[model samples]
Target: MVNIDGHTILTGVLAHPIRHSKSPLMHNNSFAKLHLNYVYLAFDALKNQFSDAVRAIRALDMRGINVSMPYKQAIMPYMDHLDETAKLAHAVNTVVNDHGVLTGYTTDGIGFVNSLLNRGIGIKGKNVIIVGAGGAATPISMQTAEEQPKQLLIFNRKNGHSFRNAERNAKLINKSHPGLAKVFDLNDRAKLKAALHDCDIFCDATSVGFGKLKDQSVVTDPSWFHPDMVVYDTVYAPLETCLMDVAKKAHVKHVYNGLGMLLEQGAASFKLWTGKRMPVDYIRKLLLKSK
Candidate 1:
């Protein structure tokens, strides 16, 4: 356990249903290994408690906090400033408090891209298909566009705000990288099948594979997947998500859950807060061992 004293700097993650999060383990262990007088914790911030949670960052003189789920977009308004990526994604997953000036950033996209790169999967010159248009999907797609993928396809439900977000995100990506991105309704099975067949990377950024929907998958048909394509799901709770299982059933060689993204994003946040690169290799081994 890390020693807590008057000089210790505090950091944490804020989210509803936050008890299941592994962030504290990843960060606190990293701080311990680096011999830094920092401690990380997880706080369950309900809807009404969010504003006060943000205030506590300043009032308590804490270093920062990682935002997740319902708070990602909600906490942005409380931030003094949003970095370019945070503004681009319209979501803030990591916030650093310099004295009382809180600056927000979106490290999810960077983490997603870096996770793929670390796994020897390059996004450049490849066709990518991503499902959903919420927080995880938006940043992942935006960052994938930054990598100059040959074709970027985003799919979401046709009726909800997510569908509108899908169209909007595609437009934003196209504005900066012309002719690189396109949006489609996820229910269009024919198009989804065709895109999956042709894409090099297929990412499920939806919540279908975890929580109460652990057995559910957005792509029910395993035949849509190809052996040459990499499948990634932004759900790590069950380890082997339904999408991952589907991909494996289809004999896809590289199928992964969201654990890598979680680790990489936490590392990015740690860097922003501590100004030191995390011992990723050691942490990776530690996480795996814990798992």
Candidate 2:
């Protein structure tokens, strides 16, 4: 771990099944490049153990931690304060601990938005369709809605209380940015097809591509994506997901994976931890060099 005279540098992980996380690689590489003495390690915790895990993190005197998957929302209640983005999305992906006080923040949405804009894909007045309504979906949808998209449609496969939770989130997003959000069932093929036809950007926010599930596919049809469509999948492992492959074969205008988002969010969290602006371009170059 990177160490300063007074600050004992440390890092942590917050994912249910975190054995396969690459965040340690990414962050540690950046730390080495910057000549910091900080070390990041992974911690796996079950759903019910999330609160306990946060307590443990506090006791560890860690500088910061990244929250992933199921624990993003669960860790919210344990935080001392929420940043504006975290409060807006009702989720926290980054946390900074300063002498036992933890402040929560969400960098996922801003990372994604920055990545899209960096690629010159403007969200203003564009129709967007987002697949999945899980932890990642909330921030992406909320931030996209705030960007004033012409329309935003969220599709989820299941129809249980989780679906209702998604609808509630959609309402929260739309309420803040009136008349821009709606939720639908992905099982309704006709509706999904129609949405795809009208969408300028399609995002996959599900865990259909990563780790042991990397071989799984999200969307089955290439025809659903047009040459004008920009497909973005928040899945970096395997580099190219099946949905992205479909987009590429369909000659889509643009396709991006989650690497940029990961980099940006990690930089954001690093800033929160150290109160220092990270060399983002260097991190980006590192990622590219790895490819």
Candidate 3:
């Protein structure tokens, strides 16, 4: 029986268009199964009211919260502390509130790393190329940078908002990461082409291949992709994004959708809130069944 008492721990997700989120389904089920006295909810807030909504976390005494879309970067200013991942990404997807002291963390990268490891692809000492540097891209970049790759090259559309964001974050991650993250304008096809020459792994951290732009591929030109290269797309909506489609057509040895990354990231937040190791396999089954 669902019960609410004075001791019930409140947790939730914050976003403007939150109804589309399946996070509540994922988190609440996990909570019920784990018997955690946590009730997760979602709050929809407009962009103008974002500041007030962030304040509501502490104002309402919420234990912790997950942030999504438009508010991830905007929410950072309100946070008291930011973990390295958040600092590098300039975004926060998870927030932990301990007696009103909110600490921000970015789990998107952790999820990507965990997903990559499970697929037997190692980022360590490997040259990497990431397309796009927006919301989905940044945290994954920050998280992947920690693995000590040989080098990290990110490309974004020239002078676009994400390219600007990526340019700023490129310096942030390189300060401590051994991989030496580099940012370049995606329009510079020659530069990106050269970077991908020795790339061991290339991940599409952009939404170009899916959503409204499902027909587009970031690397539209036939770029060089070796058989050993691991191709991944952060867009999970169509399962096989245009980038993944091209990779598959080229017979790339390993390819992955963003579903695993999404699950792993969600699992990371679950750990932060409950202090329990996630039932990954079980969660995987649930996600598959949902589809």
Candidate 4:
């Protein structure tokens, strides 16, 4: 039986729409299996309430916090420290609270890489085209660039925030990911189409085809995707995103949503909190079963 004691450690994910998160199941199951005195919860906090949320983490002495969309970047300024990954990505997805001193870290990039490797999809020497340069895309691009891909192309709409982020990321990647990273304007169909043609991997980091943009597709034409390509959409809420549905119609050999990445990042956060290895495969099955 599950029990909560006075000494039990508490953790949760902070997001605007907490109802859609499966992180509680992922973390709580691991805690239960390992017999750890930890309880995971989800807190639905709006953008304006974020500062108070962090303050609660400190005031309540919560063990950790998992951050999500709209707050990843917002939480950075409120954090006491940012790990190297979080600093480089300029975003934080996981936070470890040690005696009220919270340190932020980005597990999204490493999580994405681990998921790809776990699936037997190699990254080295492959050309990758990433769609959008928002929060989800930042760690993904950072991690992918580190894998030494032959080329890393980030496509974002012109005259927008994503374009500015992509431009900054290009300069960031050139530091250690050096010279292989490039940013393209999503408005330039000719450039985007060309990049897609040669890409071995196409990642959708935008929230198109989910939420309010459910009807929109990040890449309208499936013709740009080749049979040799692996299509991944970071939007996992709808389960089958528009891009994944189109990939299915095109008979693409490998297509995936953000589920694996989600699990991987969650696992990383769990380890950071508990200092124990997560049952990755077991958690994968739990999520798949839920789906």
- Whole-model Cα lDDT of every candidate shown, in order: 0.90, 0.82, 0.82, 0.89
What is candidate 4's lDDT per residue for 1-291, written digit by digit as tens? 249999999999998877888899899998988899999999999878888998999899999999998788989988888999999998999999999899999999988898899889989999998988877899999999989899999999988877888989999999876688888888899898788888899998887877888778877787877788899988888898888988877778889999999999999999999999888888888899995
Give the per-residue lDDT digits (tens) of candidate 1, residues 213-286.
89899988889898988999988888888888889999999999898999999999999999999889988887
Off by over 4 Å in 1: none
lDDT of 2: 0.82
Could you arrange the candidates by TM-score from highest to lowest? 1, 4, 2, 3
- Regarding TM-score, does 2 or 3 come out ahead? 2
Can you tell me which runs of candidate 2 are displaced by over 4 Å?
1-8, 158-161
For model 1, how many clashes? 0
Give candidate 4 misplaced runs (Cα > 4 Å): none
Q: Per-residue lDDT tens digits of candidate 3, residues 253-280?
A: 8988888897889899999988997677
Residue-level lDDT tens digits of model 2 in 1-291: 355455547787789788766677778777777788788889888878876788887787888899998778888989998998888788899998888889999989888888898788889999999887777888888888888889999888756445875787788976777767888987788898878888899999888887767877667788877899889999887789988888898899899998878877787888777666777787677777674
**Where does candidate 4 have its weakest 10-residue lDDT segment?**
213-222
Q: When superposed on Cα atoms, how far off is each prediction in RMSD? A: 1.1, 2.3, 2.5, 1.2
Error (Å) of candidate 2 at residue 272 is 0.7
Q: Which ten-residue region of model 2 has the weakest summed lDDT? A: 1-10
Query: Could you tell me the lDDT of residue 62 within candidate 3?
Result: 91
Model 3 regions lying over 4 Å from their true place: 1-7, 177-179, 221-224
